[model samples]
Every structure is written in structure tokens, then in C-alpha cells.
Target: MLAKFLPGARGAVLPLAILLLVVIMVVPIPAALLDIFFVTNIAISLAVLMVALNARKPLDFSAFPTVLLFTTLFRLGLNVASTRIVLVHGHEGEAAAGHVIEAFGNFLIGGDYVVGIFVFAILMIINLIVVTKGAGRVSEVSARFTLDALPGKQMAIDADLNAGLLTPDEAKARRVEVTTEADFYGSMDGSSKFVKGDAVAAMLILAANVIGGLILGPVSHGLTIAEAARAYILLAIGDALVAQLPALMLSIAAAAIVTRVSSDKDLAGQIGSQFGSPRTWTPVAGILTLLGVMPGMPHLLLLSGAAVAGFAAWKLHQIERRPPPPAPVAAVEPADQSRIGYEDVSDGMLVRLDIGYGLVPLVDERKGAPLMGRITGVRRQLSKELGFVVPQVRVVDDINLAPYTYRLVVGGVVVGEDQVSPDEMLALDTGQAVGSLRGKTAKDPTFGLDATWIAPGDADAATGAGFLVVDPGTVVATHLNHALGQNAADLLGPDEVQALLDGLKERNPQVVASLTPQPLALTTLTQILRGLLAEGISLREFRRIASAISIAAQKSPHAEDIVELIRPDLGSLIVQKLCGVREPLRVMTLEGQLEGLLGQAARADTSGRHVIEPDLGRRIVDAITRAAQPLIAEAKPFALVVQPAIRIAIRKLVKTCLPDTPVLSFFEVPEDKAVEVVAVIGASQPAQAGHFQPQALPA
Candidate 1:
């Protein structure tokens, strides 16, 4: 009930404390009140020192900079209040300022003003020259390095996000922490200047109080020169000592904070553990004992110190020789082999590579496995190219498989399986080889080209004969890469699409905010993006894609409709990727009769269900396959240019048989580029340059 009445009390502390500091500077404080304030100043400085010693890392005390500013202001206020009381009240007595100041002046200096002045000057020098200056320099360097490293740290977070090592929320939290660290270091750099200024002010205030007291006391109170000097100088010395001691302590605290390195233990623990070794203490003990026995030394004190060090060294040696405690054993429980649960039949990994038991050495680091490195490289390269992180490939050994076999599994189904000799290299024949190799003949596991398994030492010989040779590890990795490329659409889901939108928000926030939930849901956008990836397109330019989706969403919510509307905008990007910047696009053009036939088939398939007669579909598939063979044999890239309405239908017809070949609509080809008709699909041979013409499709 009482807590309910304290409305806004907790929020008013900072403003009220600042107001009190101002009051102390303007108001003339009595001796009793000055004593209370001086004690408070000392307590705060000590508390700050203890906190700094206990901190594990600099960020653990992120509020130190602000605390430093307030504490310095508090000390300066005390100095002003004390100086006024010391000069005006010096003629009365030595205890005029307060007992706190009088005791420091009398007991510490023993009535000698000269010694007090020397001590105050030394404290000011240590604080201003050594501690404060070093801390300020450290803060400046730390701030500069942190700002310079910000971009690289951000890129590291992006890389980890793409690699599936960090979730979205984790990545966001790390970014926030990085930004806060930069702000903290930069603030500390500027705040350190305040402490340095306070040290300078203390010295000037001490001198002013003493000089003003000597001149005023004899003239105003009718006292003798010696009497006035003794009274005023003592009071001035007391005032300076009371204020400078706390100022020095605060400076040391600040230095401790900026110089401290990050560690798991506090300062005391770190020092104690590092020096606890028997080897370290034993040498010190010997040195101390040797010095203690010297004839001219003080034997009592020196020998006592040596005895303590020797005892510490003996204890440390005993600790180092102690054996660890034995482990406790537990009773074994019997197995229940017949029990079954849902976990026993859970889904398999999204992408898994299972190898035979004989090939286990390919993944073992001790045996120099190159397969794991190759797989990591493939994932890294593909992640950059495809604009998303690929999940880790789970590689394991299967005893049921053949000794030389490996399988690539996706969604619990094996998509590709092959056999390779674990100790041999595969030499592929690209149809221009001149010499023969003595080895077992086979086809390349990735592309099904004619290849032979040969000895590793015969690699140079095979290369000299126009054969491409690769090790067994390369063979498995290439097969895995090709399989993943074919099914990249399957890896993309709502999570990946959301990541792409978040990245876009960094550059264009308005588009992502308006398009995602307000106009189009994530599921619809993911389907469209997956469709593009399935057709062998990169989503790196997702900012443009999002803008296109925002415009298309006003008319239709269908993924297929949206994709068709955006295809023209992305046409140049797609074409440039397939054909390099220098070469004209080589294409296999459909004959006039064949183009008309596909148009009729597309009209009959208005539902986009690919409805066509079996005979007609087979003829078209056979013709495209025949035309693509020559290009494949010569290692030249080509796309089949067709009418816009029939592109999707023909893609469906040939996707399963010729997965690597691209089918493009006329709009996808850039107008600035020239087209070369490499072959005619329905013709018997290559088309002549004068006989071939690419016909435009009817809208």
C-alpha cells in the first residue's frame, strides 16, 4: 500500500542530485554540513574503485562514463564550498573549516605547510599526467578501432546467418550489441577530458585560498603577520588535502576501467591464479632467502618475509601434486529393445550424403580427408551465387551400401547414387582425347561422360592426352553440388524469404513494410521466388524483385501471374547470366510449323496443366533432345527461344529429361544483343545462316 503512493519517485533521482550539486556551489555551507559532504565524497570514490576492481569486462560497467561525470561534478562542488569556508574563517581557529579537514592538515603534515604543499602537488601530477592521460588515450584508440571494424563485423553476422549457424533473432541481438559497444567507447573518450580538467581546477583553487587568506586576515582582524600566516595556511592545506585525495582515487578508478582486459575472473582472481604456479613462487622464495642472509641487511624483517614466501611455495607445490578425485559409478539399467516412439520415425535431414563404410576415411581429418573441405567450399560458393545460406550436409556411413558406393539424399529420397574407387582418380574423356589409359572404364558420376579410374601418378599423363583428371573426393563433391543445384527450390522456404525481405529493409524499408503482410503474404512470395530459383535464376537483386511484387499484387495474388508480370523486368539479368557479356546468344529456333503447333497446344492448356497428346509431347521432347545434343557435345551453351505463351508448357515437357537446359521467351532476350541460330530442332542438320530466322510470337 505504501509503495503505491511513490509515483515517479524513482525517476526523479538524477535531476534532484544534479540540483543539489548546483546548490552546494552557490550556498555558503557551515562547518558541520561541509564535514558531511566531504565524507560522502570519499565514500562514493571508494565505492567506484571497488566496483571497477570486481568488473569482469569493460561493458559490464557500461555506465561508468556517466558515473564519472557526475562524481567529478560532486567533487568540484565540495572544493568550492570548502575554499570559501577556509579563507573567511581562518582567523578564528585551525578547526574553522571542519574536523575532517583539520585532522588531515594537522596529523598528516604535523603543522608544516611546506610538506602539505609538496604532497598536494605530487598527487595532482600523478592524477593529471599518469592516470588520466593514459585512460583518455586508451579510450580514443578503442573508439577508432571499433568504428573501423564495424563493417567487417556486420558482414560476419550476415555470413553466419546465411550459413545457418545463427538464427534471425540471434543475429539481430548481436548487431545491437556491436552498436552499443561503439557508443560506449566513444562516450568514454570524451568523458575522460572532464576528469583531467577537475585535477587542474583543484590545484588552482588550493593556491587561491592560501594567497587570499594571507592578505586578508592581518588587515581585517588586526592580527600579526606570523599569526595570520600560521592560521590561514593550515586551514588552506587542510581544505586541499580533503578534496585532492578523493580526486586522486577517482582518477585511479577511471584508469583501472579503461586499461582492464576482458577475462572470466575479477582482478584479484586473475592475478592470484596467474601467479599461483609452484615454478613462479619457488624462484622468488629462493631469491628472498638469499637476500635475507646477507650481513648488512636487516635480518629480522627480511628473514620473516623469506619464511612467508617459502611457506607459500611449499603449499603451492603440494596443491600442484594433488591428484583429482575418482569418478562415481552408477548402476547400469537394462535395455528395452521392443519400445517404439514417434521419435524413432521422425523426418530425416533435408540434405544428407551417405557413404559406404569403406569410404569413411574421406571425412576423417586424421586420414587427410579432402571431401569435407570440398563440400564446405561448394556450400560457400553456392550460397554467394544463390543469395542464401545452404544448410550443413550431414555425411554419415551406411553399412548396407556397397563398399564403393555413395548416395545423395533429399527429403528422405535418394536422388543420385554412384560408385567410385576410394584410392583412384577419375579421368574424364571430353571427346578430343588422343591417347588411351589402362584402367576400368566408367561414366563420370556427375555428368555421365566417358571416364576411367586411373592411378593417381597417371594424372599428368591423362591430362597430357586431353583428359580431365580429378580425385575421388572431387567426384563425390561435384555430384553433390549438381544435385543441390537441381533442387535448390526445395531448400527455400518461408524462413529464407523472410531473411531476404529483412535484408531489403536495410536499403529500402518502405517497400518491404508495405509489401509483406499488408499487400502480400509470405507464402505467396516464397512460392514465386522458389519458382524463379527452380528455373535457374539468382535472387541477389531481391530489392528489384520486391518492387516488382508490390506493383503486381494490386491486380492479382496468383504466384504464376505475378511471376509472368515480373519476368520482363528480370529478362536482362537472366540473359546476361546465361550468355556472357562478349558472346552473342546461341539459340535453337523452333520451325514455323512447330511454333504454330506449340501455340495450339498452349491454347488447349489454358489451365496451365500441360494438357497435350502423348504422341505430340514425345515428338517435341525428341526433337529438343536431338538439337541439344550437339551443343552439349561441343561444350557450348545455348537456350531454346520460343513463344511466350508456350514457354511454360514446353518447360514442363522437357524439365525432367533435360534439367540443365534453359527455355527462354522472346522478351527475356535483350534487344541490344544479336541472335545466332545454331540449329533447327525439327530439321535434319544445322541451319544455314541465311535460312534461319527467329519468328516473333503473337500476343
Candidate 2:
């Protein structure tokens, strides 16, 4: 009843009990109460030991570290309480402190204080030197190893998640478990010190009790030196023994917890299953029988051991040979029925990779499934950069595809389709290859570079000719990566958004709560995030995005308005993808008159949107494309800098013509960045000019 607080059932009771521990040190208590508290301490320690023994793994008893500290505190408090009682009332009789301590001193130790002291010393040695020391070292090493393995385990979960072997929920749960395991070991590393200190404290308190009692018994209680020795020494050893026993149990329990390996069964079950094998006990039976026949040995004892070992081996052998219980047979179907299932009506897989018969060998596991391995790598890298887990890619062999073709479908639409010869290698010439190979040439499926489908035997020769050689599997993976990156927005939905919100809630619940179920609901947030993704924004910094939205929602109820308000906060994320921090942002600007014309048209419009006339829109698109050639020739990263109000309008116009260029509003470029105006479209240069000089930004 006193220990109900320790198990964490009634949280309010724990503080009161911890206060009581402090009270026990300073306040006096009756012998009867002391005995009851002593019994409770022993009971709690025994319970902890049994729990540790029954646990299949260390994490099963995750609270062991806290429990260890409380148990140690309780033991120390009792030591103080018992020491005071013995010093004050020792000369009274053998029962001065309590029946518990008195029983330990007189009956258990046979009324010999010297013998009791030796026994207490031995128990302390076992607890401190053997058990406590060993468990502490084990905990230190376990914590270090667990921390070191964290990164590799995290990567494996990411790989499994992206490769479609695990769902998003399972991946999240696994990540939490890995982090918890690391924390548990780290805590245990420190908790082991408590047991060691308790063992040492028990020894010091025993010495203090005996010495103090010796001084008081003779001077104040009118007892002789011999009488004082008999009373004080025995009482001190009794109090020490009572406390030392429980401390030993706790040490053993701590050792058991740290040393336990993960298994499906308890310690006893593990030991029994492993040791009861016929092969193990058969050797024991043979050794015992051989010893039983020796002349100098105890024949009767060895022969009895041989009989038990032989019987155990026989029983284990019979059990091993015993057939497993018969399983119930399933019933046959009553009739053949045609029915519609959910799977037939709806397709759950968001991305599907269709391959022709010639690509079958590349996906077959018996032949090493090289394509499957590369695809998993691509999924891992793509998921990391995109900031959300992409849905599974269902790779199916399609008969409709040509013998050498592969198709990538996102959301039931074929976004990318290409061909690769399964038995050949692709050697891409990056405008640096000196020699040519006699092979059928084609454009690279991903980069549009001139490539040749050369035989596998010619891969080395192609590399020797400065050609970048890749297998059919790498070619397919590269194309799929490109297609997925372009269509990433299609992969996100309410489920993924809710997943992001739920994950964010773990770290920043206030942001999620403020943003959702308020000015912005789930569907609204989903659409807003999808819009950003479509505009080539990554959600890797999800917390920043959510915070920006929460702040922006106060200004507008519309999703578009909220998104526009949040774009400045998302500016850094956007600029990073185009160029590094130290590099200047190369951008093309609209001519002053042309931009002024668009802004005036936007304000004069009735619907709050402006559309350029057909001839004018065509002229603008042509001019932007022509101006972009300078940066393209320099092979540098660039975007079109425009007014914020007309940014989206211009993005739609230039996207198809120059899909690689990102259109950024002026405010979206972080202020710290230096700007270089690569060109001015709609200037004096003709719309169809082959090239134009770029302008530099004014100071």
C-alpha cells in the first residue's frame, strides 16, 4: 500500500511519498511502523526483480531506470530510520529496533554480531563488485552502440518505406521505436550508478550505527563495554543486513535488464529451451556417468546426476521427435460466385511502372533484379529531397508496350515512356568522347543526350572512348526518377498531408492546431501544399511552411491568398534549389514598360485577373525564350524575376516554353542574395532573335 505511488499509477501520490522519504530521515517512527516499511521495501525490490526476469527484452521494462532510483532512495531512507532507532534504544534489549532487524541479528545470524558482519560484507561485495560493476559497463557499451547504429537504421527504414515494403504509418512507428530504444539505453547507463552508490552507503551506515551505539550504550545507558558491544554491534549488523539483502536483489535485477537480448520468451523459457536440447544434455549424461565410475569421486552423487541427465536427454529427444499438433483443414467452397470487390473499382497504387517482355529479366530476382535495386535507390533519394514519402511504384509487365519499351504512369496517366534494350548497355557521349562505336544510336531517355545501345561486351571500350556507360536497369531508374520528380505534386493527397500534420503535431502542436480546423481546414491546407509542390517547391522544411500558413491564415480565408502570403517565408527553400548560397541568383527581368503595362491591365480588370491578348501573349513568350538563351549558353541556373501580382500569370505563359526555368516574384528572392539580371525580355531585341546580351542589376 505504501508503494502504490512507485509504480506510477497515482502520479499525485508520488510527490507526497518522496516527501515522506525526507521526513523519515528527520522524524522518529515507532518500531512497528519501521518493520512494516522494511517489509514493503523488500516486497518492492522482489517485485522489480521478478518483472525484470519475465521481460523478453530490455525495452519491455522501459521504466526500470526510474524504478531503480526510487528503490535506492527507499533503501537509504530505511537505513537512516533504523540507524536512529538502534542508537536511541539499543541497550533496552534484542528487540530494540524492531522484530525484523532483531530477527535478522539474533535468529538469522545466530546471535553472533561478528558472523553477521562477515555475511553483510559478502553480500555487499557481490552486489557492488560483481553485479553493479558488470551491469554498468554493459549499459555504457549498449548505449554507445545503440547511438552509433541510429543513422543506419533510419536509412534502412527510409529505404523500406520508399521501396513500398512498408507503409508510412509503419515507417513512423519504427522510427519512434528506434529513438525510444536509444533513450532507454542512455538512461540505463546513468541509472546503474544508483545501485553502486546504494551498496556503498549500506556499508558506511552500518559502521556509523555500530560506533554511535557503542559510545551511547556505555555512557548514557549504564552498560559495560561488553554489554555495549553485544547490544550495539548486533543491532547495527541487523539493520545493515535487512537493507543489504534488498539492495542485492535490485542489483541483480538491473544486471538482468541490461544484459537481456530480445526474444519471444522469458528468461526461464529461454534457458529451458536452449539447455533442454538432446544434444546439450547428452554430453552432460556422458560426463556424469564417466565420473560416477571413477574411484576417487563420490559415486552415489555422480550416479544420481547421471540418472537425471540421462532422463532429461531421453525426454528432450522424444519431444524433439514428436510430430507437431495437426492443424485443422479448411473447408471447400460451396459454389463459384462472381462478385465485385473494392480492388476492382479503385486503384490504390499511385505510381505504376510498366515494362515490356524484354525488360522481364531485369526485374526477375533469380537473375538479381538489378532494376528493382536501382528503383529502390531512386525512391530513397527522391523521397529525401521531396520531403514526403512517395507512394509505392507498382512495376507490372504490360503486353501492350513494345518489346523494348517501358512506361511510367502517375495517377493513371502515362507521364513518361521510353525504351531500353535489356541485353545491351547505354553509352552516352557528353560532347567529350573522342572515338565512336559502330552501334545503333539513340537519344538518352532522361537527358536527351546522344547515346548508343552497345553490347555488354563493349561497355569497357565505350568507357575507354570517354562515353558514360550504364546498364539497362540504371537507364530505366534514371528515367523513372526524372518522371517522378516532375510529377511529384500528383503523389501527395489528404492522407499524406494529414501524415505531415500529425508528425508536426509531435514537435510543434501549436502550429498545427492554429493552422488546421480554423481559418484553414485540412482540404484547404492540402490544396495549398499541392499548389506549392506543383510550382516546384519542396516541403522538406514542413514546420516553417506550417508556421507561415498559420500566420498567413489570419489575413485571408482563401487558399490562394494564404499561399501568396506565405511565399516570402518559403523564399529560402525555393532559391536553394536553383543555386547555392554563395552563388549569385541569375535572373531575367521584364522590360519596365512591359511590366508597367501588365500591372495596369491587372488593376483595370474586373475579375481581379489579367490576360494578355493572343498576339501580345505570343510575343511575350517568344521574347522570354529568346532572352533565356544567354543563360542557357552559359549553362547557369536562372529564373524570371517579375512583379508579385503578375508572377503566377507569367509562370503559366513561360512554363511550357521553358519548363526548366522557375518564375520567382521579386520578394521571393531572399534579401541577402545578390541579383544578376541576365536579360531583359520585351526590350528592343526582336522576339525571335537567336541571342541577346544580359543586363546586370544596378547597385
> Top model by lDDT, which number?
2
* Tens-digit per-residue lDDT, 125-207, candidate 2: 88899999999999999999999999999999877865557877898889999999999999999999999888878888988
Positional deviation of residue 442's Cα in model 2 after best superposition, in angstroms: 8.4
Which pairs clash in the backbone of model 1? none
In model 2, pairs of residues that clash are: none
Where does candidate 1 stray beyond 4 Å? 1-11, 26-37, 82-115, 144-179, 211-236, 277-295, 299-349, 397-405, 411-413, 432-442, 452-467, 510-514, 604-606, 682-699
Q: CA lDDT of each candidate?
A: 0.85, 0.88
Query: Ten consecutive residues with minimal summed lDDT in candidate 2?
Result: 690-699
Query: Residue-wise lDDT of candidate 1 within 406-465, one digit each (tens)?
Result: 999977778899999989999999888887899999999888999999999899999999
Instruction: Please give the lDDT score for candidate 2.
Output: 0.88
lDDT of 2 at 442: 91
